[model samples]
Target: MTTSAALTVRVVTSLEEFKGLACEWERLLRTVPGHSFFVTWEWLYYWAKHYLRGNQLKILFVFDDRKRLIGIAPFYLRMTSVYGLISVRELRLLGSETVCSSYLDFIVNEQHKPAVLRGLYEYLFGEARKTWDVLTLSELAAESSTLDLWNELFDEAGKVGEVVGTSCCPVIRLPGDVDTYHAGLGRNRRYTLQRKTKCLQRAGRMEYARITSPREIDAAFESLVSLHQRRWGTRANGGVFADDVSRRFHREVVQVLSERGRVSLDLLTLDGRPIAAIYGFVYGETYYFYLPGFDPTAVPKASPGLLLLHHRIEQAIREGMTTVDLLQGAQPYKLEWSTGRQSLVTVRYYNRHARAVALKLGEGVKQAIKILVR
Candidate 1:
């Protein structure tokens, strides 16, 4: 909303301006057909507050002639070394590998794609060309139209981009009812799911609940982490709670999002004792499975983890969520449950500078060596 020109793109650097755009941002995000919760101000604002060390926020906004906000790009600038060899000034997305934001895309009104893309490029590569040497974005869904836009723009600009890594994100399409969803699954899988549900039933009263109350947030999150640790032991910490920073971000962000009715921390209990849990975010009628944890000591016959997933699905369907994004993984379980797989990719676009070319080449060589080794 803070801008000097009528038809120009604006760079939002101050936290005040970021906060001011909350209403418009959410409105624009909803206008977009397919978007993720990561683009939400609440999610990226806290991310910046916590893990944006040594980096400068460079969020971009594009407005129409009527001063209507149309597009938004959450970006940051930092100096990074490629494999600790070549140092390059990088302009990257708000979320990175460390943050585990499974998916990302700009919140752009489809009508203004051209203007937004052009204005953004002019700002980054023309007005402030020297500010950055390379542009990197990761975990973009392969089918994401944003990827296509970038590819088209970079192609038009005669710049070569590289695909550094790719992962499969499977998602389940929710049905009108849980029974219909179960019926849609393969007969074998349906039987397994039914058996698991019955097994849990035999273990006294089974209960499924979502934790959203402010008072219950802390205890629920602790139970989530504790059960996660118990299930994976040290591996849990390594995977999700890899460091104190990630832990701190989740602890605070979950509470913040839950307050807004955006978080869905599904908890499953067997006879009043927590057995399995999954951390999810509900945004725009889509459920994102961010993390999951279960008590490993639970009865194997019940398959507490799978049962929790089933319960979560039932809840999502009843709540009218259109899809359940399993994030990034090709696990057999995910494969069985997913209606289809979305490919997430990492992209790097180097400017026409010596350091940029060197860094790109160096990364290509490293990736090639890794492939060879594999």
Candidate 2:
């Protein structure tokens, strides 16, 4: 049975080949609901040139019978570990770390999802028959057409795909301005926010600022790293600001996104010192929250983390944004401010080989552990 009925799938190997189609690819993504600025061509291009190097980062495009591009999925051949097992894995080029990114999915044009997925799956699996061992994608948003397309393709192809894990990406729906938001929270949450803001106000001088230019980019980034380390140093988890590689990756993304008006660096200062920082991207009427860290030692009474979030919520409303995506974390605090939630799933598509049997066993064990824990 022919999997691709009418679509043409093309593999782009050279950077030039990918760059030529970048404009159309980005345009097609804008048609998707809640499409992110993080997936923009500028951001991806910078990452490819600086970080990806000579890796087989396959940038694929699916076209309709009319030769119009309908979808894109930027994947790279790399190594990933799952439950003490390591193998060559095809992952979204955007997420190299099993760390902090909350969103990961293929770009599916609004008009063609299942069809695009079928073409992509057919191409990947057919190639995998001779090439790779496993294809994995983590942090796929449950609300996206990405999951729907995967489900459709697997059902039609009669292939087995397993869900490895699930997590929540929280989002706060902005109804009105800051006061309105505070009014909507639970009594304790409301009081906490009020008390925190008031405390900060009383302590010397407090200010909020957004950094969005190439010139101001350097200092803003340094402040983020310093604050992040100070906050998470106790737990010994370096957070996003831990090392040079992660910091470089972030700065590169920001520089690319800032030029396109998609990035913002929100800073909170107290007594002339930067106390908290947030790196977020704005796209399609929503603020996609990314890395945020605060000075845990400074003004513990002010609750700097919560203070930063409160300011961002108000900022969102002031900017007329419809929502603020808190990103993927099962943190209890996400529920306090979030009015809505989205589920993110980890996907494992098995190859028909010895690897498949191994993965099946691993999946069974994982499921058993999850059930026992529950």
Candidate 3:
């Protein structure tokens, strides 16, 4: 472990420092256990450097006594229309839109999350208490220990901290081989699995292929893009694979993750040609369902995407993964396999102004629509 005498905490408020810190942050991330490509220096840097045009993205870093990076918290100071239509400031991590981003929260060294969060809140809330109205975070993973800490801190602060919103995330527990998992799903789901596997087998030699090395990453990426484009065409949200940024990010993520042997880029192929691919991460005992695509032309009969998922789950069971997390989604199929749902909540910490109230109203509107649909 690195020494702590030279340890220092800095909040990079300027773009120049932000850029420099990102370089260091990424370098350290590669060494951190379970570091994800999404939180990689390049991924976050590219997004912040591009989308943050005039948007103040404040990046905070914690250096050990040796001046070596140990933690990072990527956040932004921005103006939204909710706070009385005024430019009331707040700090938040860069994440997907409510309609899109699956989850949110900062990436810190697993060992340093507690320290980083404490330092981050101190600086953000301490300095901006007079100028900013809120300090909000969204889509935090329910299983994360940081969420538990946040709850404790909120209680200690004696300030208003609310769950605000909650949503379900489904997961599959994989034990032993695919056959064992199939048997565990019980009569109905097991029957469907048997039928689907048979149908898929009749269509072609259904084989599950995983791109496990950096050497295979390029070809696997091309296969993923080709199938994704063919599957979604113009209707699928272009943000995923339609643009250079996203495509490049995915490639880099796969390469990095494959290097660690923690990424599962599973492909369903017929004969020798690829038809469907599911890109996800297998960390510890959890398999994260990140992204997937298939050839639309081969749908109905092939059902490549669904078949690939089936195979992936089976593989996970064989690998002894305890959970196959669907991440965030309301997909009916996810419910079909998931026996339990992990509830997630969103919260915002405020210093002043009516921003909290406006946010609550927006939440109410969202809830009303959800209730109406249900």
Residues 1-374, model 1: lDDT tens digits: 32333456778887777778788788888788767788788888888878887788888878878877888888988888877887888888887747678677777867777667767776777777788888888888787777788888887866677787888888998888877987787699778878888888887788888898877888889889888877776663465765688789999998988888888788889899889999988888899988899987887788888988977888889999999999877889889788998888888877766667667566566533432233
* Predicted structure 1, TM vs. truth: 0.89
Residue 290 deviation, candidate 2, in Å?
Answer: 1.2
Using lDDT as the measure, what is the rank order of every candidate, best first?
A: 1, 2, 3
Ranking of all candidate structures by their TM-score, best first: 1, 2, 3
Write out the backbone clash pairs for model 1: none
Candidate with more favorable, higher lDDT: 1 or 2: 1
lDDT of 3 by residue, 178-238 (tens): 6666667789866776787787788777778988888987798788888878777577575
Error of 1 at 208 (Å): 2.1
The root-mean-square deviation over C-alpha atoms between each candidate and the true structure, in angstroms, is: 4.5, 4.6, 6.5
Better of 2 and 3 by lDDT: 2
lDDT of 2 by residue, 185-273 (tens): 76897787788888988887988888998789778888988898787856766576566666777777777677778888889999778
Which sections of candidate 1 miss by over 4 Å?
A: 1-6, 83-85, 201-205, 363-374
Output the worst ten-in-a-row residue range by lDDT, candidate 1: 365-374
What lDDT score goes with residue 139 in model 2? 76
| Counted clashes in each candidate structure | 0, 0, 4
- 67: Cα error in model 3, Å: 8.0
Clashing pairs in 2: none
Q: What is the TM-score of each candidate against the true structure?
A: 0.89, 0.86, 0.74
